[model samples]
Every structure is written in structure tokens, then in C-alpha cells.
Target: MAAERGRPRLARDTIVGWMVLVLFVSLLSVVIVVRESLHVSVTERANADVTQEIEEFRTFTRTGVDPETSRPFTTAERLLTVYLSRQRPGSGEVIVGYVGESGVVTTSYGAGAPDVDEYDLTRDPAVLRAAEQGTSGTLDTPAGEMRWARTVVDVRGGDDAMLLVAVFTGEGTAEADRTVRMLTLVSLGTLLLAGVISWLVAGRILRPVRQVQEAAAEITEHDLTRRITVGDDDVSGLAATFNRMLDRLEEAFRAEQRFVDDAGHELRTPITVIRGHLELMDDDPASREVTMRIVTQELDRMSRIVTDLLALAKADRPDFVRLGEEVDLPALTISLEAKVSALADRSWRLAHVAEGTARLDTQRVTQAVLQLAHNAVQHTADGDAITLSSDVVVDPDLGPALTISVADTGPGVPVAEREHIFERFAHGEPPDGRRHSGAGLGLSIVRAIAEGHGGRVDVGGTPGEGAVFTLVLPTHTPASHDHPEQT
Candidate 1:
């Protein structure tokens, strides 16, 4: 097992919770502000009407007189009756005056207002209390409630009197109460709406977190291929990051598996040969010399296989390609042609060489080309021709790329076997009576080298018409080169 890896846990869930809290506070503030404002305004309107009616009564007391006699009213009840007849308030207001219980004066409009008898001075606590205390007061009346003021009127000849004025508030209280009810209903409904909206938004925003968890739960060391689907939202970044982590995990697991597999497959033959030879050894001088030579040969083959496996394993590392300097394609191609010429007796041809300097690992590129060249030689004869060529070709979708090709005029690759030959420890079937040799790692090494350069190798052409193995490499410029994929 490898060391455990982890990332910073995203704070999306917390963010959503805080957002809902802020929404609640904002809506509550609006309800309180609007409710308080409406309450203050309505209360002031009711109090203003009460104060205005009291002022009207005071002014009349100082100026009233009898119309027919052209002199002051003869009685307090007369003055009260004259005032009530002249005054008319809004439908919501009722002005009732009490003339010391001698008579009552009431002006009524709405259905809810009371009759003159209902305004009896002795029956109303507001009137009684005001008269006793010589101050304005309020009381619950038949017309819901009234705010009343009292004044003592002194006549020149008649008995001193009492005058009371009150404004009935049945309609006003009902209206204010209705307004409050409506505001409360609106506030509740708005809060409910805000809650629903906030909940939906929060769910949508944190959907990616659920997806990440689902993907993570399903992934195992043997299977890291699952990835989360995401949209173009803020959480998309998190999804992409999660996907990258999965990719790393999968690559690491595969690399470990390959190391075990390759070690067992390549090391088995040498160890068996060494043990068998040592066990069958004799004391004879000639037999010992032959045994030592055979053992030495087997040991050398094991060393080569180990070195090749190490090279292939390192292909997955970031520093596998060290394209630190410029490589001249023409010079490298010429050098490769010179090198592979001695591997066989084939008529090797330097078909074409493009003159250009590119950012590349010269040794790895040469190694891949030399591998292809040697593979061509192994499959060909003395008179058969093998050609190595290089040229920069332009592609509309891929831009400019360097094409390195090795073509052989021999029993060419079969259509179905070309892909198989490039896989690790894979070998193509020999033609007719011929036998294939080596650990079958040649083409795979070439492939690893190509991918290490952020490029790829592909085989084409027809069987018996000579196959062409091409290495299509980008110029290693950032705009042209992409991060390499697994070989």
C-alpha cells in the first residue's frame, strides 16, 4: 500500500449555511422596519384627530352665541347642540358632546357609530372621569372606543355646565388592525418564500460536493477511473481538481502493478537458468567452463531486461523528458542512420532529413529512432532496403509537427498485429518458418520514449507492401505541445 493522500476540504456547505442565515436576517429587518413605520403612522393619525376635535370645542366655547337673539346661548346644552350640528368628520370619526346629562349631542355616520342615546354622559366612564378630573381621557365605548375632552362652561344667568367632546374610533381601529394583519401576513409569506429560495439555491451550489463524495466513495485502489461530472459554476473548479487527483492515483496504481508484473516476467528465466546450471554442475574442468559462460550470458540478458524495465517505468515520471537544449533534426537523423547501419546487412537509406532546431531530448529521440531502425533490420535481409526519413509537416488541427518515419521493404506488419506489437512484453507472430527473439520490449520502449516527448508513434502502410512506423512529434512549444498521456 502507498501513503495516503488528501486535499483541503472545500467549505461550500458552510458558505451555503451562512448565506441562508444572512437571508433570514435581511428579511426580518425588512418586516420590523416596515411594521414599526406603519404602526407609528396609524397611531399618530388617531391621536391627531382626537387633539383636533378638542381644539374645535375650545374655540367654539369662546365664540358661540344664539343665532336668532343675536346674543350668547342661553344654556350650555344649546351651545353643545349648535356645535354638533355644524361639525361633520370623516366616516371613521364620530363627534359626541354631553351637556351635563341635561341632553346629549351625537353626530353619527357609519353603521358602526352609535345613536345619541348611546352617548349618555352618565353611561360613559370617559365622560365621568374627564369631568371629575378636569382633563381629557379615553374609555371603551359601544362604538369601540372614544377619546374625549371636557370643559366647564359658566353661563351669566343659568347654572354652570359641563361640555364633553369625543371622537369615536371604531373604523380607525379596524383599519389599523387590518393594516397590521395584512403586514404580518405579508411578512410571513415573504419569509417562507425566502426560505424556499435560499434552500434551493443552497442545494444547487453544493451539488458538486455530493458528486465528489459519490465519486470518492466508489473509487478503490484497483479502480480509480471514476470521475465526477460538473457544470460551469464555482464548484466546477473543485470537480476539475478532484478529477486530476483521480488521474494521479490511477497512474500510480498502474505503475506499481507494472513494476511487479515486469519484474516477475523478465527475471524468471535468468533465475531458473542460474539455479538449474548450478545444480547440474560437475567437478570436470571443461564442464565448469561451459557452465560459467552460459551463466555469464544469462546474467547479461537479465541485466539488459532490468535496465529496459527501469527505463520504461521512469517514462511515467515528470522528469522523464529533459528537453533542456536544442536538437538539430538533420544532425540527429544522420547520426541515427549512421548508428543503426552496423546492426544488420540491409541497404539502409537516409531517405529525407529536414533541417531544423527543436527543443527535444536528443538521446531519447535517437534511442527511439535507433530502436525502430534495429527492428527494421531484424525483419529484413542483406538486399532488402530500409529507409529513415524526417520532415516537418503542417496539420490544420495540430499545427506544425516533426514526422520521423522508418519504412522497411520486408515481410511487413499485419494490420491486426501492429497495435499489439507496441504493448509491453508483446511480440508479433513470425512469418512462415522464422522465429522471433528478444524480450519483446523494443517497440514498447520506443513508444514510451515517444510519449515522454509528448508525442506518439503510429504504424501504417500495407502488409507485404512494407509498413511505415511514424513518430509524430510536436515542436515542444507550449501552444503546440500538451501534457503527455499514458503510453
Candidate 2:
């Protein structure tokens, strides 16, 4: 069956698009606020200028007298007419009138004046009261759509006159409106420019991220050599970290592939041997017994291979084996040493065997110990001393552990192959070019058993001084302890 799709559909480009949208929205909000502030400022300034003009006109109309003739006017109308006729064209226009003492307007700027008397100023209560009390008042005229400032002033001849100054705000209001429109357009243009720039900047920032994603997507099990180039920034750090992770993954993949290939090669050997032996039996009856013996040996070798593979697979599982009854470390070491001595004439000796106890699967522990001893014997000569020893050590960080060591007095492992000596199919050849006879699963199985028991194994030695292999197992602590006598 074809492999199911495992890649992500939303790529890095989709994320870049989202970032652009967010930046645009942020820019738009800023533009709106700035535009509104500008409009308000313009309107406020226009209103202030119009108010100042009204104030200046009121001061002139109230305090000014003719320079040539120092004569006061009889009525407010004559004074306002003189003021208007004498006013400069650029000095804003002012219209004056008078109301009775009871707040009645008896005279105005007269007829034939444009918008001078278009609206009744006295009809407005504020203006009428201002006239009665001789105070300044502002009125809104809908007909002219302008603001007029009215002040009641006493003429030089003691006649009460109402001074009306209509400050035309239509022009100023129109200017403010135009300014708002222009500001809005400018703000929108600026926002557009900013959005474009932000999009470009965001694209530049995400370029490395896109590269990383692309590089990762292109990396498959078959092709793990792809790498991403990064600039000298945070992206460089990210790229370095990613490359490190890829390095580890690649190493693991290579290790797994080697394991598979070696397993296959090892398995084929026994099958081929059995096939050859069985085929020879069909040619001669006298050789049938010899052929049967050869076939039996091949089958045994195949059985050992299958068994070791199963053990290794099981050891990989999280809960492959559980702790059993406590076993005495010293007793176990003695037994393993005796077995090694009997199997080979090598000088196998037990030393410094600590009286410690461990809760372990006894069968597996015994098997692991035997595997280590067998490896030691195979590597050393008949007369070489192979010392088997055990000790109880306390480490503050790791608590108590029972350590077992098998040291041989022969040539140690080579520097190049020392690290991988415990790996599958890593049986080291003899110094004289003689190969060891075994499935090469002994050390690997020993490692698996030690690790499965929450322990570890270490192997190291000087050249020509024979190697020392130590297995450290955690000491068992029972729930209820009655201290047993050390044997």
C-alpha cells in the first residue's frame, strides 16, 4: 500500500500572508487617529481666529472717536455708520445698532445693507439681556448662518446703543472642512506606504523561516543531507539548533540501517550452511550421518541468532522485564567465575566480591553475567588471568549500586573500536588475525540486560593491558527492611 500523506498543508507562505494582514490593520488604525487629531487642531485654530476678530471689532467700536472732530454722536446708528464708513477694508466689517432700555431694537444698520439686518438680533434672549445690561452677548443667526457678538455701549452723548458685530465663520468652517479632507487623504496614503514597507520587512524577516521549512520538508529518511543557510542573527542560532537535531537523527538512522543489514547478513549464513549440508546428504548415504551433524550445528546456530534477536527486541520495550526476588551479588559472581573457569582453562579468579543484594530477574542477570564472562575468556589465552569481582558503591547522586567487573590479562580493545565494542555484531578479532567463534551478541545482550535493570556497563583499558568490563546494578530497597546478616 502507498504511504499515507504525512506533510503539512499550510506552508510558511500562509503565515507570511497573515503577518502582512495584521501589519496593514495596525497601520490603518494609527492613520485614523492621526487624521482625526489633525482635523480637530485645524478646527480649533479657525474658531479661535474668528473669536479674536470679534473681540477686536468690539473694542474699536466701543472706544474709538473721530480724530478731526471730537464730537459725540446722538444715536447709536449715526456712530455705527461713521465707524463703518471710516473702517479700512481689510479690518473686518462691523455693524452696530441700538435697542430701547426695555431691550427693544429701535434702529439698525438701516436698509440697503447686505445681511446687516437680515435677522432680528433682539429676538434672541441672550442678545436682548446683553443690551439691557450693557454686556457682550453672542447669537447664532440661522438666516445668515453666522455668529454675531452683540455688546450694548453708551454713546458719548449718553444714548444707549447696541453694538452688533457679525463674525462670518462660513469661510473658516469651509477651510477647516477642506483641511480635514486633505489630512484624511494624506493619512490614507501614508498608511498605504507603511503597509507596503511593513510587508516587505516582514517578508525579509520570514525568509529564513521559509528556508528552514523548505529544507525540513525536503528531508526524508533516504535523503538527510539537506541544510539551511542562515544570516548572522537569531535565525542563525535556530538553524544551528536544527542542524544539530538533524545530526542526531541521521546518526540514529544510520545505526538502525546497519542493525538491519547486519541482522540479515548474520541470519543468511546459518540458512545457507543448513541448505548446503542437506543438499550434500542427497548425494551419498555414507555421508548422511555427517550431513545430519552439520545440519544440526547450523540449526543450532540459527536458533541462537533468533533467540538473541528476540532478546534484543524485547529489551527495547519499556516494560519488557520486571524485578524478581533479591539475589546475592557475591554468590552470583562466584558462580559465574566457576562456570567461566570450567568452560575454558583460562585463569578465572574472583576478587573483592562485595556482599550486596539486588532485586532483579535472576535468570536474566545470570545470563548477562555469563555472557560477559564468556567474552572475557574468548579474548584471553589459556593461562591468562580473568578476574571476576563485585563491589557495593554508594554515589550521592545515584544512590547505592552493586558493581561487577571482569578483567582479563590480555591485549585490550583498539582505540577506534572501543566505543562500539558493545554494539551488535562487534566481536573483536584476535591479535593474530584469528576470529572469535560466536554470534557476536554476547556484549550487546550484556548491555541490554544491564540497561533493562536501570543500570549501565562501562569498558575501558590501556593498550596491551587487557580490558576491564564493569556492570553497575542498582541496589534493591525493600518496603519493610529487617537488616539481614552479611554472608
Candidate 3:
């Protein structure tokens, strides 16, 4: 297929070539028209000069007398001499006559023989043709073509004879030929100028395009920050779009880097614990059993950390959550209370429920709330109270919101960690001396789910008082006309 197709043309070169071709053709056309006009003017002048010379010769031959000398010519021979010497034609003109048996070459101009008798009239096709025609016409002669005319006159010596008057146009044609040569040169020069202009203009317009190519070439995995400079034209607009794409790629790269670092760090501790316990195992059944139990527990912790990281990673995907679910807030709140009751002996109660429904990922919302309930249980006493609530609120700037909060009577987060408590690997130290094996991924998971629904998570409480973790999610898409009426 590749061989079957012809080679591609470069845009700049093609355009320039076309421009030059058009210029050459146009100028050549002008040159032809101008050259033809010059030839016509030259021919007209030559024919006129020859015609007037013939008329003058005829008048003297018939009258047989010179207007200046005012005397009758006795014979054809005398008439010929008077016409040649007395009324000779201008430069580049020729005159010849034949009276009875005598022939004479009266005048000659330009190069070649001055005597006309040197060449026989009968053998010369030009002179013979002119004599046969009996009128003025162009003919090929020794001095090139002549615009000649001929007439027969009765000679006093005896019989009638021929007279000729002609002008050589070869010399007259020189000026027209020079004009045509100059025109041809001018046409070629015009074509060159046109090609140069086309090439320069194409380069100027494609400058930004070249910049985009260079910028794209410079981009790499480690350095996605390269950007192309924009200009004022449409090609510059394309460069702007190219820069924006690079920005998005750079952001995605940084995000992936952070994800890898966080995942590696979180999995390190459990892996170390598992390795240490397995290495220190003894041959005795009791020691082996204890090691197995410790290793198994660490494995469970590691599994949970991996699960949380996977969830966070998928949160950025398009189908990460079931966004089409129409969740019933009252029913969701009731189910959450019943579910969290199994976590601990804490008093799990439903504090509030919004009357209406919301559009969101129901399963994800439940998972987030469940994570918060577990966190609260981990920090609170066995008998402490925990309240789960779901209510929708309307704000001028934020629109309608589905706010679900979990409040517990536990060791609340300290004032210092409030801002970053929702960050991955950010957690409050357990109040009790006994340590809890949480991956510090619960709140971050909760925040991810909330933000996935175009919302956020916030905490509210004093340092000593029980803290309330609120998951405030926007239930409605900003431009949603999918559900015209409130659900």
C-alpha cells in the first residue's frame, strides 16, 4: 500500500510552487500580448514605407521627367538613372528597374550587395513572386524578407519593363525582439519574487506550530512541566490547548507518585511484623502456635491497609461509586444505627433523619459512616453513647446538602490535628494504654467518598468533649435537570 501511494508534498513548498507557477503563467501571457503588439506596429511601419516608395517610382516612370529638372526623359535608361540618384528611398530601402534589355540596381541600404543586377530577378523567388502578384507583398530576399511592390511600364527604348521598390524589415524587427527578451526576463524575476514571499509567509504562520512540536518533544515522565509559548493566531490557540493537556498529565503523574509512596509506607509495618515473628519461631508446638496467631493477626491488619489503599486509588475513577442510586435518608440512617450496634456495647442511637431522599452512591455512603462508627468505637469506652444522624441542609453558596454525622462520647481529636485529621495516615493516638491496629485510613476513606459525590467531611468538638465527624455531601449535581423535582 505504501509503495502504491505517491510521496506526500510539504505544505509550505507546495503553496510556494503554486504561487510561482501562477505568476509565471500570468507574466508570460502579458509578454505574448505585448510582443505581438510590438510586431504589428513594426510591420505596419515597414509596409507603409514600401507602399509610398512604389507610388513615387510609378509617377516618375509614367511622366518620364524629373519634377526638379523639369525635362522629359528620352529613354527608359535615363528615367532609371534619374529615379535612382534623384529620388532614392530612405535607409535600409532597395530600388531596382529593368528597361528593355538593360537592367540597373538603383539603390541599396544596410548590409549586402549595393548592385541589384548581381542577383537574377528570374531566379530569385521573392522578386518573381512580387512581379507575378503585381502588388505590394512580403518576400524572402538575399537581405532577408523584403516588403516589395512591382509595376510594369512602357520604356521609350521599345518594350515594357518592371520596376521594384522594397524595404528590408530584418533591421526594423531588432527593436521588437529586444523588447520580447526583456519581458521574458521580467516574468522570470517576478516568479522568483513570488516564491520567496510565499516561503517566508508560510514559515511565519507555522512558527507556533513548530514551537508546539518542540515542547512536546521535551516532555518526559520525570519532567511533564514543559509548556509551549502561545501566539495571537489560531495555531497559538492550539498551543494553549497543548499546554493545558500537559498540565493535566503532570497532575496525574504527581498523584500516582503520592499514591505509591503512601501504599508502600502503610504496608511496611505489618510486613516487618510478619517477617520478625516467622523468623523467631521455635520448634515447640506452643511457640509455633503463638507465632502463627501473631502472624495471622498482622496479616489481617495488612489486608485491611491494602483494601483501604485500593479504595482510595479507585475513588478517582469514573465508576468508583454508584452515583445513580436514589438513597432514602431516613432508611439509611436507621440501617446505619442497627449495623454499628454490633461493633461495641456503646449506645448506638439515631439522632436525626432528613424527611426526603438524596441522589448518591448509597453503598459508599454506608461504608463511610460505618468507618466513622468503627473509629468512634475504637476510641470510646464500652458504655459511651454514639449518635448517627442524616439531614439535608440548603446553603446559598453550596446548594442542597446531605449531611450525615457520627457523634461519639470518646477521646476526641486534639485541637492541633483538626486540620489534617482527614489526611491519609493521619490519626489521633488512642487514649487508652492498649494500642489499636488501625491503618489511619478511615477518615481519609470517608473524605474520599464524600468528595467523590462532590462534597466534603468536617469534624466539630472541643479538645476534651466528644467529637462529631460530619460527612457533608452535595446530594444534587450542580446542573442536574435529571430530577426536576426534589427527591
Q: Give the TM-score of candidate 2.
A: 0.61
Model-by-model lDDT, in order?
Answer: 0.74, 0.65, 0.75
Give model 1's clash tally.
0
* Candidate 2 structure quality by residue, lDDT tens digits, 1-487: 0121212223334554575577657666765776566656544543454456457546865576654576545666565556556543221223545543534333333222235355554466665555456444344455433344555567665556555554444444455567667766776676667656756766666666666677776899998888777678775677778888888778768767766776798889888888887776665766887888888888888788878877876665444445656787767877777776786888778788788677866667778877877887877777889888888898554479888888887777777776687878777754545577778887888898887777778887766778888887778643332123232
Which candidate number would show the highest TM-score if scored against the true structure?
1
- Estimate, for each residue in 85-167, the C-alpha lDDT of model 1 and write its tens digit: 77766445556555555655554343445565665444666566666886676677665666666666776666555555555
Cα RMSD (angstroms) for every candidate in the order listed: 6.4, 8.8, 8.4
lDDT of 2 at 463: 60
Ranking by lDDT: 3, 1, 2
For model 2, state the Cα shift of residue 152 in Å.
Answer: 4.8
| TM-score of every prediction relative to native | 0.70, 0.61, 0.64
Candidate 2 segments whose C-alpha is farther than 4 A from its true place = 1-145, 151-160, 174-182, 230-249, 283-289, 309-349, 355-368, 377-386, 392-403, 408-434, 444-468, 472-487
Between candidates 2 and 3, name the one with more favorable lDDT. 3
lDDT score, candidate 3, position 40: 86
User: Candidates sorted by TM-score, descending order?
Assistant: 1, 3, 2
